[model samples]
Target: MSISPVNCPNTDCYWSAHGIPDKYTEARAWHLAAHRAEEHGELLTAEQVAYATRAGHTLPNCARTAAAVAAAPEPIPARWDRTVILPEHPNGDLDGQTIVCCITDDGTKRPIGLFLDDEHREALGLLLVDPNGEDEEHATLLAEVQRLKTELAQAQEDIAFTERNTLPELRRTVEHHQDGKKRWRDRAQKAEARVAELEAERHTTNEALSDAAQQLRANSDRITELEAELTKYVGKEPTIAEEMEYLSGCLNAVRDLCDATEKQATRWEHPLPVPEWVETVRAATDGVRPDDPNDNRHRILVDGKGNGWISVCSDEGTEWVVPIQPAAHVEQDVRDVADETGSLREIGRCW
Candidate 1:
């Protein structure tokens, strides 16, 4: 499965005039361009019209970059850079051989091409001679080749006919005539014109079909190439889908933890009136959440075991979770706050 790239030569067709766009120069893209030309009556550039080898395979003027890239040969090793035309090794079997070899500045030989031993050389000498009295067999083979070529041509014609007309339509055309003899005669001219139009349309349809089939094959080849390349990195890195799944799992775990903590925090019992210092600490530590309905205080979560945590935001715009301890811990903190005030006054004392 190989794709031969075609260049769109139409200077005015989409982006062809300025240059063969990188995207359009690809095998599939160019094949689609060809289909458009055949199926949609699109105009091609002058060079494409003039130089296309097939109905839709045209080479555009702007194909220089693509052509150069394609035409560039695979690099040969430096050792085989030089060639010698059958001069040094003047055996009859090697008469016209152009041997690739490494040649030093002073013309010392570094062998690269055929190096035949004496026995091998003798065998090749005998094998090169034509068999005696085989002229008739050669002539028969040539005729068979020509016959096969003719059969291939006929097969192509059959395929074109099959594409252009259905079997039933062909049978009807062969078996019936329209109206009476005179009526048929009168319609003959119009029938001929219609036939010509249909033939042209059929040709266009065939070209479009060929272009589409070629593009499909090219796409299949490209998909196979990509899949093969992907296999090379199968275990090296996680795919995007795998990464997303892992991240989603981590997020769900965090949400569950938050939910559990919230449940536990609500399980704790409290007296009707909270202490003044505790109220002051709650007011000071309450988070601001303008967008939340419960914006008056911190959002807290608890678990089944009565373990809980509070979610709060600091003035610096950072969010954190603080673990909830036993009520005694809170009472002690409240007393400490009261004692820190000057003269150790009542809960109403101002710092």
Candidate 2:
């Protein structure tokens, strides 16, 4: 089925400025009209006007009125009830008259020139030109020329429409895509920078952890050496007297070594650490005397079991003795005070 092409009511529209041909489809006509309304400020339909109004867009005065007229149906011509009269040609030649006709709904002949204005009459005259005594081939060539002219005009109109309506929208679309791409690129650059920063931080942290691990290993080795030295000093349990004797020998050996090194003009760079047991023996033996009857004097003494005693004696015999509990070793300062004062008062105070 053939579709009737819709003519846009806006006389200023591109489609209306150009004539609609038989080949112009209904869909194409509406599409062009819609384009003209949107891009050219010439609304051709009632719906477009209403939409523009609701969207708070002001349309041109000409377009606002044209939309309503476009929505209304085309007026139907009144039927001719009386007999028609033919007008005389100005040239006074009936044979040369160019008559335009139309077939009504009832299949009766009607003069189309009655409805046309001067401009349309001139257009109809061109179309109705008589091909007097012209060959069939010449007529065919003329028809082809007319058809080509119509097609060329249609092509020019299509090009103009595209340039006016579609090109700007395409450019805007391209710009929008470019902006999106730029934003994404900026985000990517930031992400890359952040990743590099984190990587640098991780590298520094790894170096610190490696240094700590090396230091820990060195500390572990020092601890192991200290444990070995401790074990060598106190490998087995011994009596207090034997332990004291052994520490005394070690002290004499260290003193002899120092004396020999000094005599030879030698130096020792790193000295050995003194064992803790040496301090224990020194505390136990401080202000204590050896067992000797020949040297009769008042003194403090320590036994093998770490017990203490105060031996007070006259030139003739031992007078009094005070026993002290184990581990209560006497301080050398208190003994020196007792000896200097010729009294046991300081010693008693200490006890």
Candidate 3:
């Protein structure tokens, strides 16, 4: 828009105020602008609005800009940059249409409407056809696309790093390390079950042995009592009643002893299990309890041979079956004392 003011005949009157009123020139002359129709009732069509603006009578003030457009006499929006009458192409179709842009003439108060081919119009559609801007929207969109691409790349890199390094390590811990723990747990469970069975058998055997021992003690006492009675009777050259009573007492003692002997025989029939059953239990465990005290170490067994196993043992000497050796127990310390280190050094040298 140029600043050298031209004389406006209807000065401050938005319309041209001097053009012939036609189909497009709804109204003209000074401050008053009206959409006077060639026919009544219909608001001026957009085609009419453009035509009127170009004629310099309808919206003469708008040089494609609304304020400039409002300077026109007519009440029309500036969405219409301009309009063009279509011309027939050599192909005989009106397919190649011309779009007139209401380009503001820098030095003149007039709107310089220029023609655009169909292709240009399509491009203009992409760049808003109004205000006649180009590629501005696409430029904004392109920047957003670039930002998304950069973010996506970083995310993919993080994923790749995890797969190559962190994920593999995690998987190894889960699959191999954790699996080893499960195997140990299973072995421990088996050992425990065996120990329980052996313990039950041992309990029963001990109970029988105790009963036998009690019976034997009772029998011994009875025999002593009978001997005392016989001693007194022997001195008196014991009468028939005394002799008979002593004999009866001796016989009763023999009978009690016999019962005790039978019970003891049965009880002792199954001897205490050899250490191997315990060792087997331990060997079954491969006896390595690095975490417990030896005093807590215990052996369990079934009464019969080859029938028992060891449960948890405190002694590190025990062994258990495993694919790999059990991990050595580690002691956590904030720091090893210097004196302790010196002692260890001396021990190492001596050893």
TM-score of each prediction = 0.20, 0.32, 0.24
Q: After superposition, how far is residue 45 of candidate 2 from its true place, in Å?
A: 24
TM-score of candidate 2 against the unseen true structure: 0.32
After superposition, candidate 2 runs with Cα above 4 Å error = 1-174, 243-306, 310-323, 326-351
Q: Which 10 successive residues of model 1 have the least lDDT summed?
A: 342-351
Q: Write the per-residue lDDT of candidate 2 for residues 228-330, one digit (tens) a residue.
A: 9899879587977687567556655765655555444434465555555554544333433244656544555443334345654333443344555555443
Query: Between the candidate structures 1 and 3, which one is better when assessed by lDDT?
Result: 1
Q: Whose lDDT is greatest here?
A: 2
Q: Which should have the higher lDDT, number 1 or number 2?
A: 2
Residue 248 C-alpha lDDT in model 1:
45
Off by over 4 Å in 3: 1-140, 216-351
RMSD to native for every prediction? Answer: 42.2, 19.0, 38.2
The candidate that achieves the highest TM-score relative to the unseen native structure: 2
Looking at model 3, residue 266 earns an lDDT score of: 58
